[model samples]
Every structure is written in structure tokens, then in C-alpha cells.
Target chain A: MLFDYVYAVDMAHTAEHGARKAGTRKRADAERNIAAIITAAADSLARDPDASMTDIAKAAGLGRVTLYAHFPSREDLLRSVLAQTIAESTGIIEAVSPDEGQAAEAFARMIRSCWPLLSRFGSLHAAAQRALPAGEVRRRHDQPMAYVERIIARGRAEGAFRTDLPVEWLVTTVYTLLHAAADEAAAGRLATDAAGEILEKTLLAALKPE
Target chain B: MLFDYVYAVDMAHTAEHGARKAGTRKRADAERNIAAIITAAADSLARDPDASMTDIAKAAGLGRVTLYAHFPSREDLLRSVLAQTIAESTGIIEAVSPDEGQAAEAFARMIRSCWPLLSRFGSLHAAAQRALPAGEVRRRHDQPMAYVERIIARGRAEGAFRTDLPVEWLVTTVYTLLHAAADEAAAGRLATDAAGEILEKTLLAALKPE
Candidate 1:
């Protein structure tokens, strides 16, 4: 519910690029520019969010005008990188079947799948909140969160997860833990593997039935 | 801890204002202006992190020259607000005796004390990270975190909490949950009262011996 308020991006987070023609170098160039721009922007913003479009263009090995043509403003470039990150993370959840397994197993699987993405895009996610309103970020995060909701529901049905707390609250707690772990790993305070292991155990323990 | 890396602003977070001789309204005027500046900056930046010093002076009902005299740059103003808030928060946490009670009870009290401050300052914290290097923020947080570490150590000694996972990992997990819950409440995704209750239960559950 907090997400509904803080991350209210429009529901559609993906770029709708048409399929490329196999023989055209032009299409390849378009694809490369988009990828390079997003990657470069994520890295640049991660370091200094105020990094100019020129800095990003230099990082991406593109001309300033070419970068401008692809992304009209610094906000536009950051937005694209953020959306791409969210879409890719949502794609990770889409690969999992929250309904097909024991609630606990699916929960663990989703955590494993989701944590690294959270770590990889940790700075970008923070950038998204700063550049966009809370509402916009909330909506962009909704897709991946829905999968999380489904897993909690399935876990409840299997009587594996406690139901004392509302499902929404439980969901937020798990996310809080994962994000914290990811932050630790990103800062090198905790090893990535150790963060994951600790999260899996603590998250599962917290969700277990009384 | 991620905090060890990102929130270290030196252990002495308290303001050490110099004592002044009585009968000088000038001393009071100077103190009031600094407080007003920090307060105004926090509110304005929470709304828009890019809010200008002029905007902050307007909010504080002071002139631009005065605001500039107090905080030379936008970054200076934001960093001060962050430090003041951290100092106040660390003061809240320092008043509580973490090792004196059952770890779970102390943990709950700490959350009850911390979540609101985290919610109130969430944007300011984000603004600080963007304005300064992560190392500065990390140092500021280290003072409060040392208290949290003591609680976890006590819990482990009492056999009331898990030890397989390092104490540092557990401490970060709790901070993460508080922050995430604070984010939810700040966004109004969850009610403040409900977030507190849910957090208390979940945190306690997670820390219980498996």
C-alpha cells in the first residue's frame, strides 16, 4: 500500500520497440544506442545523479546530439534506465510460477531471483524515486510486486506462512528485508552470497506459521 | 553493516553549541536562524529535493542573503539538515537502554522510536546521499547503529535470537524493515498505527530462536 503511494508510475514500464529487420544495420544501430544509453545512464547516475547528458553520452561512446535524439532530457534518460530495470526485474518474476509450488519454496525462489536485480539496480531505483514522483515509481514497481503478493497468498493457503499480519504488511516486511540485504551487499558491508543466505533464512523464519 | 559503509558521519552526532553570556538577543537570533534554516530546508527538500536556497529562505521567512550566509550552497543546506536530523534521531536512540531489557522488547521500542523519524527524514536522507558521498552519511549513522549492535549481541547471548547469521546481518535487517515500513507509511500505503504493529510482530518473529 505504501508502494501504491511512493512508486505510482504508470503501469506500463516497457519500451515498445518494433522487431528489427534482419538485414538492416540501421535497426542494429537503433538497438545498440538504446541499450548503450540505458546501461551508461544507470552507471553514471549510480555515481552522480546530477551527471549531465553529455557525461552520459561520453560514457556510452555516443555523440551528444545522438544521445539527445534518443533521450530528450536527463530526466528522460534516467527514466528509461529505471523503466528498463523494472521491466527486467518483473521479467524475473514472470519466469517463476508462484502458484505451482509449496509457498515457502516459491517464496525462496522469488527472493533469490529478485535480490540481485534489486542490488544491481539499487542506485537506479533510488534515482527513480528522486527523478519521478512517488506515484510513478509505485506503479512501475507494481508488476513485480504482484507476483510477490501471489506467492504470499499461495503460502497462506498452504498454511506455511503466518496470517496474523495482513498479507500486505507481510509483503512489505519481506521486501524491506531483501532491500536492506541488497543495500548491505552493494555497499560491500556484507558479501553478496552471505546477504542472500541470511535473507532467505530470516525471511522464511519470519513468514512461517506460529 | 551497510551503515558502516554509507552512514558514517563521525560518532559524535550531537551538536556542541557554544555557551553564550546572557542578555544578548543576538545569540538567540543566530541560533533561531540556524534552526529555522535547517527546518525549512528539510520541508522544502522533502517536497522537491531540487528546491533552491531561495525557496528555503522564503519558507523560513528569511531573506536569501541570510539563508546563503547560513548555508552557502544547496548541498551545504541539505547536508546540514541531514546531519541535524541524524543527530536528533541518534539522541532519541541514545536515550533508550537497549541492553537493559529483553532484546525483543528493546527492539520493538527502538522501532517505535525510529520509524517515524525515518519516515519524516526519508527524503532528506535520500537527498543527502545524492548531495554527498555515501561515506559521509554512513559515518553519521554509525553512532546509532552501535546501539543496535549491542541489542543483537545481548539477544544472542540470551539465546533468544539466532547466531548462525552474523549479528551485523541481523542489525541491518531490522533497520531495513524499519526503513521500508517508514517508506510505506510516508507514502500512505499502510496506516502508521498498522505499520507499527505489523513491524513489531514481524521483527520479533524474525528474531525469535528457530
Candidate 2:
């Protein structure tokens, strides 16, 4: 999946480029600090959604005023972090080769690419799904949903999937299971690799000829 | 599936016969009041696991003394609610027959029976999963897990399901997707029926033979 690939790139850059940018006296330093703050805040919020602003500031090694300057309110900060994460995820969804191999294989690859972000930021995803009005998030959600729907449709056209249920139902099911498996992984009930395997099997089953 | 049927029977009895009994006699009324108190406390605790005893008593329409008489501490009350709910769920699990028809049909029926309770008490479940190792909740989780394991085992033995993944992983995926779908349903992102349909497809995909 392109989303998974984007996340990998983002994670690598954040780790390798973070300290180097901090040492330089330039715009890079400021951007690095902002990224650090967002990452720290995301980690704390994952553990406790209601964690205080001061606590997040402390985790990011910034003063409350500095944190507020970068992002005005708790919601604003959270929204920014989520937007960045979603952008990275969207990039991955766009990058996948929809024409590559069988529909099920391509779909599984997309899920694998996106699993890390979904697993790490699952609570935030849940919050976004709940907090955002349908207008904003719907478009974001539709992008991925469309991708999955296309895959299911292609599978059916190729005679690989049973055409008994609506493609929308299949898309919704795939996303729900992904989000659910990610949540379970976050909660320590299932390992990430195990979740990936489950996703693969699930996609295969959903696509198998009846 | 058997377990879910049993749970429905038990829940129907609790709702119908139990309610009627409480209405008939003073002693039964008192017991019912106590049960109601516990249920209210459980609800509050689900929303806020750290809610105080006084807060629970206030919510339950009981005095602190009476609440303590029924459940001496927060742990006791939480444990009792957990046990009762799991026992009820176990009844439902025991009532299902995964062999009732084709595997997919049986799985769909099972998911329908199981989704509502999971959706309603999901937060409490998340709390219980987190509160393990400090109490008897761990022991209680075993019953449902065992029931699910048996279903998966039976499915695999009958050549109705893929044998690559552990049965436990399949069981956990079923619970996870149901919980996730419930979360979506609760948040109004998806209607209840829609969520149920999505869950059914997801489970069928995950469990059906490849």
C-alpha cells in the first residue's frame, strides 16, 4: 500500500533527520521542533485522550506558551497531528498499484502499508471518526474507501469474489476490521504481525468465489 | 453461536421474568433495587473507570451505605458486573451452533446475536481488558475465549475454515471487528444495521474457506 510506504518514509525521516535539524540554526530546526511536539502529543493522547495541555507540552520539552503558539488549543493541536498522519496515509492509498497482481493481493499490500499508522494512532482515528463532522472526514475516508471498493469490484469482475453483497459493505467491513485489529494491537491483545496475517486471510475470504 | 443463543435466553429472562418478579414482592423489589444500583454503577464506571463510590451511589439512586452493603468496594462492584455480563455472554455463546447450516450462515447469525452487547459494553470491555492481572477478571475472560476457541476448532475440523492462522487469532478478530463496528455505530458514523452488515461480511471473509 502507498500509505504504508509513506508512513515508513515519514518514520525514517523523523528519526534520522530529527536530531540533525535540531543542531542546525535554520527553518529546519523550527519544523523539527513542531514535528517533535506533535509526535509527543500524539503518544500521550493515545494513552489518555484527556491528557492535559501542560502534560503534552512537558512531553514535547516545550513551555505551555510555546505549545500554544505552535497550536492554539488542544483540539487544534490534535487536528494538526491527525491531518499530517492522514495526509501520509492518503499518500500511501494513492500510491498502491491497483492494477498489480490479483485484487486480493493488492488490497492486502495496501492494508499492510497502512497498518502501522492505524495501529499507532488508532485512538486518534477513533476520535477523528467521532469528532469531525461528516463534511471534512468524509472526503478523507472516501479516498481509502474508494480504493477498497474498486478492488472488490475488480475482484468480482474477475470472477474471484462472490457478488452476493454490495461492494460498499465489503469496503466498510475491510476498514472496520483494519481499525479493529489496529485497536486490538494497541491494547496489547494481538501482535501487529498477527493482525496483518488476519487482515490477509480476511481479504482473501471476502474475495473468494462463493 | 450456541453461547450467544444461551445469552439471549438468559437476558430475556432477566428482562422479563426477573423484572416481573421484582415488581411482585417487597423482598424481590429490594433485591432488584440492589441490582439496579449495581447496573447504574457499572454504567458510570464504563464511562469513567475512576468514578468514585459516592458518584456511583448518586447515579444509582442509593445511599453510600446501601451501595457499600451491596458491594463493599469499587473492585467488588466492577468485578460483579463483569462476571454477570460475561456469564450472560457465555450463555449466548453456548446457545449457538456453528454447525447449524453452511459455515457462513451460522457465522452471520452468531455475529448478529453478539454485536449488540459488544457495542453497548465496549468501553467496559476495554477497561476489563486493561484491568487484568489485578483481579478475577482474567479468570472470567477465559469462559468466552474458550467458547470462541471451540467454535473455531469445530469450523477448522469440519474443513469450513482456513487452518493457517491460530484459532485464537480468528476468535480475537471476530471480537475486535464487532467492537470496532459497535464503536462506529455508537458514534453515528454508520447505522447499527449497516455496522452489523459490515461485521457479517468481515467475519465471513475471515472465517470462510479460501
Candidate 3:
């Protein structure tokens, strides 16, 4: 219902902003198909990084021909997933708006808010990390990492976080723990709520000054 | 050279005691073959969790017949990897002997000793986790977990660590961070030494009393 309402609004806005662009049904349909395929592939990859082209196609409820039409190869499909991951990660960081409030509280808030997405996207991220070199993955993840680094630097400057470590190390450790929380959840060793709570508490305690 | 010396000594001892068990060249050759295959498979799996049987065979410089002779299927191969992982993890934890020092120091020693092995064998462990159910992985990992948990409990008892959280949560968080450290190393985001130092410092800080 919410999507319908929002999508309806989007359609009206797009129609007004550029009717020629919005009026192209064939182009719009292709765009929708690509989005659906990418979303399905992301879900499949998150479940199993080695998910096959056939599996992805099946998951998307698209024919093999259609999937192949959009993505000529598995690498192409993975590229789309990488793009989605980068965009989603940046969007999540932006939405959390880590610049607000006390740096410590802000950091905790980011962890709490980011846990679900981190865990949900865990496999996709891991898959991307595996497929790409660290340098490439880092480059793609630069914006989000920088956003996190800024918040952590602020926390360190405010004397909330320890001053002994570099901001990169601190941010990396936070991400590592976040990924760990996601692994715990995915492994069913910890429920999402429990994982988030433990992570938030541990990270807050660890990152805070002695 | 070590294996040859050990094998010679074992043969002499067995001849003096009972030769039947140690007398066969075929059996000894089979044992060596199996060991080599497992070691190679571990390496290949660590490099690529979905490493194919043929790829493992090539890595070990063995034939399909020999590889299949040892592990009938991918599941069987993965089961061996899981066993190897369990044994190695247990050995690392036992070697650390978390009972030997102040609980915090013991934890650090454990981290320092385990980091190299953990990062090296990370993909194999991840593959095992994916192959086995969580309960099975936990069961296999229980001994090591218990060892870490014992140290954390001692720390809490001695009032060196926080007491508000359950020991299980503390121990889980520690392993989570360790795995994260391993991930960082594997991803090349942090060098092994740096990852270890950051992880040790951060973990000790987090688990210690406020």
C-alpha cells in the first residue's frame, strides 16, 4: 500500500517533469525488469554467494533469455549487485546522518540502525569483497567509509573514543564487528534483536574512553 | 625430513612391538596421500570456498581416482575440512591455555596466537559453516568457545571485566570481533599484524570493566 501510494506519486511527478521520458512504456518496462532482476540476484547472492545464473533467474521469476538479455554473464550480474550494494550502503549511511547528537550516541545510533541492513546484505558484501580486489572494493565503498570515518573522528576528537588508534582502524573495527553481528544473525547463533543489542552495547563500551 | 624421520622411528618401534599394523607400504602411502589431499583441499577451499574437486586434485598433484578415493563427494570433502577446522581451532585455543595468565592477558595471548591461523583458514571455516547447520558448527566449536568463555568468566569474577552481560554474550562478542579481524586480513583492508593489534586492543578495552 505504501509502495503503491509512493509509486503513484512518483509516476505523477515523472510524468510532469518529463512526459517523453515517462511515456516510453518499452523503456520503462525494461528498467523495471532490470531492477527486479537485480533485487532478486542480490537476495540470492546474500543467501549464497555462489548462487548460479539459473538460480538467480529462477529467483527473479524471469526467463533465462530475459536474464541473459539484461546481464550477459555472471560477472555482469555481479557488477550490478556491486553497484546496488554501494548505493544501498551509501544511502543507509546518509539516512543515519551520523553527524547528529553526541558523537558517542550518534555512533551507537548508527550501529543500531545499520545492523539489520549490514546483516541482511552480509553475503552480498562478502561476495563482492571476494570477487573484487580490496582496492577496488575500497574504492567503491569510499563514500560510506568516509562518512563513517568522519563520525568516528569526531567521536575521537570529543574524547568519547580512544585516541590511540587511527580513525581508519577504528572505523574498520566497527565495520568488522558489525559484519560479525551480521554473521551471528545469519548463522542463527544470535537473533537479529539480540545481535543488535549486544553489538550496540559492546561497540559503545569498546569505542568509549576508558 | 621430519615426516621421514618420524615414520622411520615409528616403523622401528612397531617392528619391535608388533609389525602387522605398520608393515604395509600401501597403507602408509594411502595415509600420506590422504593427508596431502586434505592439506591441499584446505588451502584451495580457503582460497575459494566453492573450489571444485578437480581443482583440489590439481592442487594436491593427485588424480581424480585418488581424490575421490578419499572423499566420495563435495560434502565428504567439506566434512574433512570441518574436522580439520575443528581440530585446528581446538588446538589453537588449547595452546593459548587461557588459564595461564590474568584473564585479560590470556585473552590477548589467545588472539595473538589464533589470528594467523584464523585468517589463513577463514574461508574454510566459512565454507564449513555454510555446509553444516548452525547447531553442528556450534557443537564442533563448543570446546574452543568454552575455553574462551572460561577466561571471560574468570575476568568477570575477578571484577576485571564487565559483569552485567552474560558470559556467553561476552565470549560471543569476542569471537565475532576475532572473525572480523580475520575478515579484515582476508580482505586486505588491514595487514595481519595491524589487524591483530587493533583487535587485541579493542577487545581488551571493550570487555574490561568500565
Candidate 4:
């Protein structure tokens, strides 16, 4: 019903605006619908990794036809949502100085700044892993992971982090710990307020030289 | 075809053993069938957490009817598989002396002994979490987790492990690390041959006193 009303308004505006203006207006409306669908999908998928397309469409206040017209397929929709989420998190990570001061301190600063991204989008990560190929999922994570990898490499080079373990293993361990912290907080087993502090302390302890 | 042959042989045995003995014989056959299904389900689930009942039935060499008779639902089958896996691991964990030597050494022993359990049954864990309630899944882990908790408590008391972090969080962190090691090994990022050694080193490093 809501979509029908929007469609009626769009037709009336198309008649009033003429061909060129109406073409631009239609394009803008289509872009708005796509944004709404992506936003709704991210929220829906975060809440339930297996949320249905119909449910997401309803949440977006658009019909299934409109949603499909934009996404074409579930994979396309998931990829877009993941890209959007990564873009948002990249903005947060950029604000933290990964090269400033001691490597360990930089790691702490990065974790404190970006921990919420893990907590907020953990479910979305799970969803993408289920729908996308392993390589595809890993590739999407490459950019964000590179930020941590640099800090870990600097830590190792400076002898601030343990050299006994492989740097790749250490990077994987940090990510696994962050994901675990998010799971614990979501399960109510750990206090959300203290999760970041706990995570930073634990990761620093684990990464320090023997 | 194989099950049909087995059915025919069983019918012949029923007649040969007579009514009284056949009842006992039939019970034994049922038990054997149940064991086969559980074994097949574990292997199938470990390979693919989403393995269907039909696939499990084919793998067990029994019909879907027989499989369903034994396990009316996927949850029932998953619970039985999880329980059996835990029982096997419990036997392994029992052999390790959690009280002998330094707490850190004892932890190494326990992790060394039970690390395979985490690696082997990781997929089944994912399956159970999907099929069962969160509390139900956690309850199934109580026995295995209690052993680790006791060791962590002793370590904290003896000042072998760090006391700065909450015991609960530390226990969870150890588990998260183990699971991550298994995942890395499975992905070929971490060598299976060195996983236990690496796991022991990283976990001991994280748990040691500052």
C-alpha cells in the first residue's frame, strides 16, 4: 500500500516535470529505493543471518519487484550490503592512527576505535560467509585486515610483539578474539561496557614478547 | 538394496531364534543400527554441518524410514552426535592430570590432549548451535568446560595465570583461541602438524601472569 501510494505520486510528478526532468526524477527515486533496501537488509541480516528477501522488502517499505529490480539476486544484495558496511567501518578505522607511537599502543588505539564494528557486523560477516565463496569473503576482509596486519608487522619488527608465532597466525588470532568478544557481549555473558577494555588488554597480553 | 538384504536376513534370524530369543536378537539389531546412524551422522555433519537426513541415511546404509525411526528430528540426531563426541573427549580429558605439576604445564597437557576434539568436532558444534537453544547447547558443554574452569581457577590461585582479567573471560578466550586454531588448520593457513604446539604456546602466553 505504501509503495502503491509512492508510485502514484511518482506518476503525477513525471507528468508535471516533463520528459527530461521526469527521467532524472525517476533515477533519483530508484536510487532512494536502492539505499532503503540496502539499509533494511543490513539491519535485517544483522538481526537474523537467514532473514528472507520478502521480509527485507517489507522492512524497506518497497515491493518485492522493486527490491529484485535493484538487487537482481541475493548474492548481489549481500555483496552491496557488505561493501556498504565495510565502507562505514573503513571510515571509523581511518580516524585511528595505526602508525602513531608504539606499535602496541597503536594496536590498542585501533582496537578501541574499531571494536564496535566487529560487534555490530559480526552477524553480517557470518551471513556473507554462508552465501559467498570462501575466497570472496576473505577478499572483502582484505582491506580491513591489512590495517591490523601493518600494526602487527610493526610490532614484530620492533620486538614489541612475540616473534615465536607467525605474523599471519597472530593476525588471525586477533580477529578471532575480537569476534569472540562480540559474541560474548551479544550473549550477555560479558559486560558490553567492558568488552573493549577486556579485548585490548587480552590482545596486548597475547601479542607481547615472551 | 543393502538394507533390503539385511532386512531379509534379520527376518530369517527372527524365525531361527524363536519368539523369545528373537525379541532379544531384534533389540540387539536395533542397537547396532542406532550406532551406525550415529557414527555416520557424526562424520557427515563434521564434513558438512548442513547434511540432510536423507544424506545421512544414505551414508549409514539405511533407509530414511529407519533413520527417522531412530531420530525423529534433526535436533534429536544432532544432540545424540554432540553427546557422543563429548563422551569420547571426556575420556581423553580424564587421562590428563589437571592437578599435577605447574598450572601452566597442566594446561598445556589438557590442551594437547583435547585439542583434537575441538578440531574434529568443530562443524558439529556449529550444527548443534543452529538446531538447539543457546542454553541447551551450553549445557551440553558443561562437563568439558568445567575441567578447563578448574584448571584456570587453580592457575589464578597459584599466580601462574594472570589475575587482571576475569576468570570467565579468560576461559572464554582460551576456547575462542582453540576454535580459531582449528579453523586456521582447516583452512590450510595453519599447519595441522604444528597446531597443537602453536596453540599451547599462544594460550600459555595469553594466560601467564603479567
Give the root-mean-square deviation of each candidate in angstroms. 15.6, 15.9, 11.0, 8.4
Model 3, residue A155: displacement in angstroms? 3.1
Which digits, one per residue and each the tens of the lDDT, describe model 3 over residues B1-210? 999999999989878666565557668988899898889988987767667899999999999999999889877888877788778877987887789878888888988888888888756765555565434655677778888888898888888899866576677677766765665566566677667778788888889776
Off by over 4 Å in 2: A1-32, A43-55, A68-75, A97-102, A116-142, A157-159, A184-197, B1-31, B37-84, B96-142, B181-201
Clash count, one per candidate: 23, 19, 0, 0
lDDT of each prediction vs. the true structure?
Answer: 0.74, 0.70, 0.77, 0.82
Model 2 chain B lDDT-worst window of ten: B129-138
TM-score order of candidates, best first?
4, 1, 3, 2
As for candidate 4, its clashing pairs are none
Better of 3 and 4 by DockQ: 4
Q: Which scores greater on lDDT, model 2 or model 4?
A: 4
In angstroms, the error of model 1 at B131 is 4.0
Against the true structure, whose TM-score is highest? Answer: 4
Question: In model 3, which runs have C-alpha deviations exceeding 4 angstroms?
Answer: A1-23, A41-61, A72-79, A99-102, A119-140, A186-188, A194-197, B1-23, B43-65, B72-78, B99-102, B119-140, B163-169, B186-196
Give one digit per residue, the lDDT tens place, for model 4 in A32-136: 999999999988877666778998999999999999999988889999999998878767777887877899989998899887776776466666656764446
How do the residues A1-210 of candidate 2 rate in per-residue lDDT, one tens digit apiece? 899999999999998797666667656767877898899888876655445789889999988887888888776876787777777777887787865779777877888888776777745654444344333444567766777788888888888887876565566667766766765566666777667767777667766765
In order of lDDT, best first, we have 4, 3, 1, 2
Location of the lowest summed lDDT over 10 successive residues in candidate 3 chain A: A129-138
How does model 4 score by TM-score? 0.81
